[model samples]
Target chain A: MTEQRILHGADMLTERGRAEWDAAGVQVSALVDNPYKKDFPLLATKPSLAFLDSAATAQRPAVVLDAQRNFYESMNANALRGLYKLSVEATEAINASRAHVARFLGLTDADARDIIFCRNASEALNIVASSYGGSVLAAGDEVCITIMEHHSNLIPWQQVCERAGAKLVYMYVGEDGVLTEEEMRAKIGPKTKVVSAAHVSNVLGVENDIKLLASIAHEFGAVMVVDGAQSVPHLQVNVRDLDVDFFAFSAHKAFGPLGIGVLWGRHELLEAMPPFLTGGEMIDSVTEQAAVWAPTPEKFEAGTQDAAGIFALDAALTYMEGVGYEAIQMRESALVHTCMHRLADLDFVRIIGPADPALHHGVISFNVCGIHPHDVSSILDMDNVAIRAGHHCAQPLLAHLGIESCCRASLAFYNDSADIDKLISGLQHVWSMFHGD
Target chain B: MGEGIYNAALMEHNAHPDYKYEMENPTHTHEGVNPSCGDDIILSLRVVDGIVEEAAFTGSGCAVSQASADIMADLITEEPVEEVKRLCELFLAMIRGEACEEELEDLGEAAELKSIALMPARVKCAELGWRTALTIIEEEL
Candidate 1:
């Protein structure tokens, strides 16, 4: 067994959780065969493909597709408008999906109406920046974010701060690509009003201690907003345990259908902010003079929602719960360990992210010394291995590291050791093509 | 070696580029950047009496960009500035999948890159250096 499997087994060996694991028959081992791939229909069609770009977006499972198809087949009607049977059933299914999604994130309080659905993580972050950050930020206020944030999270804050004449501050990572506590304290000061960052960096694949960051932000009277697009899919997240003010993620990255995302915020803060969009069902009362907006969640979601995607997201959460996060971690850690060790043996390969493979949950970024990353990926594509190569929308971080671009190989639970071997072999082919001088 | 994009001629130019260096006191110079992939190229020409006496380039990019720039530098040396511009326009047309009527004997090894038209994503990479050279003569001169 790998160290990750041992550690995972130890966490679940307690008397109470042991019974749950036993009842579920969850196998606590570094996955050798990729048992979860059978559920993902995309892999079945492309049998020869070695997909290493899960960080961009993951392949959807069959259950998620079936749920979406079933919604369109049976409950195909506009929700919240009609009183007929099909419309009512569609509305009920959507509402039930909302409840299920909330429960998946450990937001179980019946009275807490904190979940608001949107298009993707980008739109969700925009809601917080425009609606919440726009209303509160002013000339002297500062919005603090990390340098490793995706463009989606960074640009929205820049727009809001530029409009309000507030300062945009960045907490930078060190040479090892890990954000330290000392840097956080130095960057986040008394003037900080909103502290936003990624729970797990998309390129670096290193998880930040958001719980500690939230505590520190609270000490400075700043609200914490987390981009959980990369973190929530691979790890077990309890929103209440982190005590964050707002959290956002996408469904497509977590083996669900696309066009569905979520923004979860505390009820009081959400109620204090104005609506992000205003139309049809989002209005309580409308007149020629002025309009009264609806409640917290409905006020943020104005137009017609993607009901089919929401239903599929509910199925995705259920599927993840069935496989469990522990197994997911063990499987990915083994693959990372295998791939990183092989990559490290090559003299020309320079690995990014942390030194320890444990720190890199499922993503690893690397660069060949004399070869451009785009060339590396192009050669690898000929071998049917898909990887991402570019600045990866984190151009600021790449500039800080003094690199133009790099190649990234990210993993999902459906991946196994064979995928890692193919990635290594493909990289060798890239070397042979470029380094035969 | 795989046969499609990284052929032997392209790889030879990229491996040991004769003109891949900065020139001293060039008549014209231009830098081009591809923001999509962050590939950059600097084209420098030593022109004398309306002719390119010597040509050299310095930059970093993919195999396509580097090889195309090196081959373009070798072709433009000792040619008239007007002829260099014509060759650049012809090369751009070839990479854009247009029909080539002119005999590109002056282009030398660069004519072999006509197959680059099939790889649409890399057309910009192969054209960066030629475009930079054209920009220098058209605007700077």
Candidate 2:
């Protein structure tokens, strides 16, 4: 028996099994020892850090940092302007970033033309609500959104509905954070002109069935808009397969830099809708009185774009592609399963979403009995375990769950079993601190 | 676990808060919410003949916030409304760690929350009820 085989102590093993155990030990040790502390330069300084807040924002890899630095140092110039070679390089880099995002989202060339780069997912959702839903939706029209939507998705529709004299219909989520097919059909009626829901709920961590929701919307002649912020990073999302009319996500949440977001809309809808924001690059021609807007994406991208950030975002997408969706999904699933199983052992830990980890992707929300989530988070922070606590910007959903707030431990591809162990210990500490055990 | 921000006095007040109940009839009731953590409270006061007759609070919050409100209610009851407002200002200052010994002594057990200043994130949690009391008193005046 080899050293690794003896250390793990599985069912009586052969020589070949011992060798495989040795190799597996090396791989797991790399993840357990360093976790994301090495891959992401941000955590390099904190050797024993445990970051379980990836649901808020992920730590960027060294490559993403290097890509941003390369853009600023080597090809620092304004994109889509100037005739110099440097300008052309900068512009090409931005376009390349767009192409990378399109390929990552599995969009075709025609669909790629409809992709609009905005500030963040909130801006992308606003673009749809203001430009498309605002102009087209008339009085008596209905906009359907789920109760589990973040305020970014909820408030915008509320504003649009009030301004247009339209009605805002809500589809309720079950106790398990799932919308039934019956609820989808019932809420989305003939008067429904737009249907918006998150592909995966940030707080609930439950992945919604976008294909089914889209089909229901299409039957009513309503366009389907998906908030892909919580889903795109953890899962393999093909926009074409989902057949969603509009999909919005933040680059920062997907291991990319901040100030860069993506909005993927149907080409036909982009052609029909007016521009969201108008400025220099967005105008094809201007004669003081009359200004002709540029086509599709350019008409929407106003002001100076974050070219360096876009380059970093492209690097992030490239890094994700290198890791591949299958590997990412498998790693995240195992980690979440370990977490759910362990948290389940603690009776005080009341999980807010689905009981099964398979229903979730990379996030878990729970609250400890007799301890406020804020207090729990504070105690955990003392142990160097970073977690998110509060309404998670889904107050309506929290209210529906009969909780004011919850403590969320979100994972990433870089996290491992060690991180989960640390979280469990931190939670135990919180309980002891509060309950005086 | 025994020490730090969750001190003995805070825990004592949180576990068996003397003033954590609704008043039979209140002249003023103010609802306060800390949107950050969802710490909410309903502070009710009975002011009659220019004197604070009774003060009570009912809420769900962290120990610091709920205990702080309970302590405030206990200290301010039966005092003149003007004196109650003065005590509220003193308590707020003490929690911010800006009050002198004489000012803190005026606040009674609420002065124990002076350590809250160290935890800036929780300063709001300790002051939600106090701020609500100020708003109610100001409206009455």
Docking class of 2: acceptable
Best by DockQ: 1
The interface root-mean-square deviations, each candidate in sequence, come to 6.2, 7.5
Worst-scoring 10-residue span by lDDT in model 1 chain A: A1-10
lDDT of 2 by residue, A197-304 (tens): 999999989999999999999999999999999998898888889988999999999999988999999888988899888788998899979899898789899888
lDDT of 1 by residue, A112-213 (tens): 368899999999999999999999999999999999999999999999999999999999998777888998999888999999999999999999889988
lDDT of 2 at A165: 96
lDDT per residue for candidate 2 within B1-141, as digits (tens), equals 234677778888888999999899999999999988879999999999988899999979988889989989998899998999999888888876678998777887888888778878889999999999999989865
Give the DockQ-based CAPRI class for model 1.
Answer: acceptable
TM-score of each: 0.91, 0.91
- Candidate 2 deviant stretches above 4 angstroms: A1-36, A109-111, B1-3, B48-53, B94-97, B100-102
